[model samples]
Target: MDQWIKTILEEFGAIGVGALMLLENVFPPIPSELVMPWAGYSVSQGKSSFLAIVSAGSAGSFAGAWAWFWFARRIGKERLANWVDAHGAWLTITRDDIERVDHWFNDWGAAAVLLCRMIPGLRTLISVPAGFANMPPEKFSVYTGIGTVAWTALLAAVGLWLGKNYGDLARPLSWVSTAVIACLFSIWVYRLVQQRRTGSPHKVR
Candidate 1:
């Protein structure tokens, strides 16, 4: 993974950042933690502009979000739920989180879509619930666009600052990002385990 990221940084640079962000949103396994920082470092190296990199990343994120939203809208809740139950591993969604998201979507309406994008793991997954709830297309796009751009810009800034200390920062930044990803995955796994053991649902909101 490290070698792959380094290669992308060396070759495509900021464009790689955008592509990876899109993939990250659509696929979840592609870590934006690594991509954003690399883009930041590239900016520091004068390889790319920070604003441009953020824009590309945000665009990719929006595309991914839209894809999920459309899927939800088309499939409807019962069908999507059955499909998720059959192929749960690939989806990475929990019944509890789904229930909670549904409740929030019902209570908050279109506003929940914007708020959900601000949360870490919830950002991409929220689109699914929004779609299922039949959120207005224009509203979803507007809120998602605002949130995606803000989040991407924030991460890019962090990357740019780390890039300033390129020699000393690279190793530490790599470790930090790795640790964060590991922790997040661990939490997700732990939640799954707890859900299984206790047969309790996850609550959203």
Candidate 2:
């Protein structure tokens, strides 16, 4: 990862930042927590502008999300719901849960996309659901851009303030990221069980 990031920074400059952000969305192993802060540190070192970094990151985020959205859109609703019915239990989810989620996603996806983008680990994953729900492309792009840019700004600001200590800052950010993902998964599990036993529609919101 170190060598890969270095390659991106050296080869692509600001564009590389955007490309890596896209990759970060596609591949969870590539963490934005590490990348954005380093971009901030680079700003402190006079290597890049904070605004450029944030814009590039946000653009990359949108592109990556768009890829997922398109993939889900192509997969379509019936097939996905069928897969969920077959495999949801392994993930502690159910088709009924999916129906409720789809209904909610269709109803409130704009806000959902915006809010998830503000979250640490959920931003990219939200796009898949949006696509699965067949959300309007323009609406998805608008909300995604809003949320990704805000998140990029916040992360860049943290990096700018921390500067050289960006390395030090990574530890706690990792913990926070993990905690957030865990919390979300826990909620999904709890909701899955609840809906399964009670036969009710449990909205993600």
Candidate 3:
């Protein structure tokens, strides 16, 4: 993963950063943690500009989020549920969870979409629920844009700072990324456990 990131940074620079962010939002496997910091390192190496990197990353995120939004609109809830039931194993979303997501969309509306972007795994899945709930396109776009920009800027800054440290930056950055992901995962797991214990289902409301 590290070598692939370095190669992309060396070869494609800011464009690579943007593309990765887009893929991360759509696919969920691509890690922005690796991409943004590498872009920062590239800037430190005089290979790219910080503004360009951030811009690309943000644009990619917006595009990806928009795609998901439209997808939700097209598929709607019943069809999506059917599709999930058939292929849910691949994505790991359960029937109960899908129903809960639908409930969240109904209760919290677009704000749930925005908050989901800030979360790790929930980010991609929220789009489906947002679609299921039939959230307003304009509101969804606005909130999604805000979340994407904030996330992109935060990651870019971390990358930039680490880039300055050169050889020393990689280890610390890796450790930090691992810790952050672990913490986020733990919190999510805790919430899931709590929800299960309460018999309140997985939906936020």
Query: Total clashing residue pairs per candidate?
Result: 2, 0, 1
My TM-score estimates for the predictions, one after another, are: 0.86, 0.69, 0.79
Q: Write down the lDDT of every candidate, Cα atoms only.
A: 0.77, 0.74, 0.74
RMSD of candidates 1 onward, in order: 3.4, 5.7, 4.8
Task: Name the candidate that leads on lDDT.
Answer: 1
List clashing residue pairs in candidate 2. Answer: none
Put down candidate 2 lDDT per residue, 1-205, tens digits, no spaces: 5445645765666798898899988975566776776677667767788888888988998899899889889997677767766665545555665566567667775898998887765667677779887789999889888888988888888877876655454455445556655765677678667767875332322
Ordering by TM-score: 1, 3, 2
TM-score of model 3 (CA atoms)? 0.79
lDDT for each residue of candidate 3 in 1-205, tens digit (9 for 90 to 100)? 5566677768887788888889988876566776777777677777899899989988888888888878988978777666656665435455677788778767887778778777767777787777666778888888888887787778788777767865557666667656656775676577666655765332323
Off by over 4 Å in 2: 2-7, 81-107, 164-205
- Give the distance in Å from residue 134's predicted Cα in candidate 3 to where it truly belongs: 2.5
Summarize candidate 1's per-residue lDDT along 119-141 as a digit string, tens digits: 77778888988999788899899
